[model samples]
Target: MLAKAFYPTEYKKQKENSWIRVCVRFLLLITLGVPSNTLGSFQITDDISKLSVLKQNIPRDYNISVSYVPKELAGMCWVKLNIYYLEESLNELAKKFGNVSSNKNDIKILIDMLQDMRLPLGHLDPIMYDFECHFRNEQWQTEQYFDYVKDLLKAAEDNISDDCDPPPCPTTLPTGKGFDVI
Candidate 1:
């Protein structure tokens, strides 16, 4: 009754009609390319300095620093860092939800994706090695390095699944006071 008062039949119909019109127009615009003016301006550049500036914009946490990475290594380091963070997040998610049968397949897909990514990430290790050996010793800050490695190791240990038992799936349908029949 209160919903009817707030949104009368005529108003609801008009609102729904407007929404449908919007969706149709959007679909039409997609089917027919949008006007050039709507896209605004875009430019491609091979400028190295501009690349460095763009690289600076990549997000970072306290544990990772890209500011001191050499220009040649900046891009590879960024990729490695992103993969590391993604693998960490997925592992955490797996630890939390992978026991659920429904989530196992999705987690496996993510793990497979990570494995694929590790190929490219492995190729970039020479860049990382150069950065660590040649550039890092001089430019890299070490104050938090030990703490960061320690935390990373601890997280790795926590995410280890070998020690944990998978949750058991029920063969029979559940029956209890709280269970409802469909």
Candidate 2:
């Protein structure tokens, strides 16, 4: 007589099983302590940590020559390496999310994390300035050296733009920039 009587027992069993599956999934999520809303943030945080590690591994004594690449370039190189890793991580996140622009809040969180990480590197500004001055004067040694310097300069510019307001900037190296070769 009731609507329930119209459905077969098999249909009712399937409905109950689906509800059980949903409940199990919800419980698992809660037990894992990963709130659904903060999952993206956790992924972003993990990526930032990995970037920090990569930045730390850059050789502090990295120098080409006393006359060409100064010892100060080591710090600048670290900054460049950081930017490159950050860009790669962001790209991977973008791919995972598929159209990250729509998720403005996630983008903001990522940018905030990046800015915080870069805060300590602010002290390197004087070194960067000296590099820029030398760059403008064509003081670098070879064509490869000049391209490498340009790549570093491009990375620096990308870093500055990323620290600005919303909409994370694109990281573009100069034409001949080699990956990790510097």
Candidate 3:
């Protein structure tokens, strides 16, 4: 038909170019987004600055620097996180996720992984927590958020591989969908 006749070669080239662009975009997001903000950078809970809770879950290594940027929290949210991690390079530890999966269950796997690392509370009954860590509405946009998660996973992965103290049980770890705990 028309596809096979006039534009066959041009059409094919166009398709190939489109595919290349998509891949480049994905890589760009994954590379730039993944390391600095997507996966490995450390993320203190959005509300970690809330006195008691911040004290409760202080990281063993890096300190969380809270910028009281109420005005620019929105204007500078993503940019700030990006710049912060860019300087620290904490994003180097994170694994960037591509487009979200259609499957809810797959999403659950990431949530489960977070719990196993003790970043989140044990998963059980209700999603609410006596104490829980949560992302701000804008957090998902930053590379730092995922990086924090990556750091915890890196620890748990090392722990499980080393047979050290038999990584905490799921219920004990308290992480999953619709659940939170301190």
Candidate 4:
């Protein structure tokens, strides 16, 4: 046949390369359509800044109710809950995927974000007092409280639809596709 008579190995290699190039182009086309404006960064909820909720939820008595906590404080309560949840999730991920997995990167990023969010020593009293009475019930370890930060970061990452900035606009298009880039 024509294939056997010609440079067959070179032809086969060319075909393989074409397939890879096509696949890459197709993936770029699909992902590129997602606009930059639609993307958002991973960050804490803005509910903490609402003065009205803070006024209402700031405890005036020794007894506190976690259910009535403001959104910002509720963010903390969720962080507390997530510490245990993430520990368990990581255990499960380890069991399924062995020690190394994609989730490990996510875990590391979460840990870094949590450390950044840590409350300063000076402002810890009222927050800790309310957290202990309303959220912890009895008493929670300081280490455990800090550990919850990983969960907060993970949650924020999950909440963000587009964690990274949109890819740069495509500057060139293949001549055969007859595509124009503006």
| Winner by lDDT | 2
Deviation (Å) of 77 in candidate 4: 9.8
TM-score for all predictions?
A: 0.27, 0.25, 0.21, 0.25
Error of 1 at 110 (Å): 1.4
lDDT of each: 0.39, 0.40, 0.34, 0.38
Q: Estimate the overall C-alpha local distance difference test score of candidate 4.
A: 0.38
62-171 per-residue lDDT for model 3 (tens digits): 33332211212222122222222222322222223234522223334445334433332233222212112321222222334435434434433333221112112244
Candidate topping TM-score: 1
Residue pairs whose backbone atoms clash in candidate 2: none
Clashes of 4: 0
User: Compared with the true structure, what per-residue lDDT tens digits does model 4 show for residues 1-182?
Assistant: 35556588989999999999999999998877553223543444332233233223333332211112222434534443333334433343234433464434444444344343432112433433444323222222323322333335555445522122222333453243222221
As for lDDT, the candidate ahead, 2 or 4, is 2
What local lDDT score does residue 48 receive in model 2, on the 0 to 100 scale?
31
Each model's backbone clash number = 0, 0, 22, 0
lDDT winner, 1 or 2: 2
Can you tell me which runs of candidate 4 are displaced by over 4 Å?
A: 1-98, 119-126, 136-182
Task: Rank candidates by TM-score, best first.
Answer: 1, 4, 2, 3
Candidate 3 Cα deviation (angstroms), residue 98:
16
Off by over 4 Å in 3: 1-104, 116-140, 160-182
State how far residue 40 of model 3 sits from its true place (Å). 23
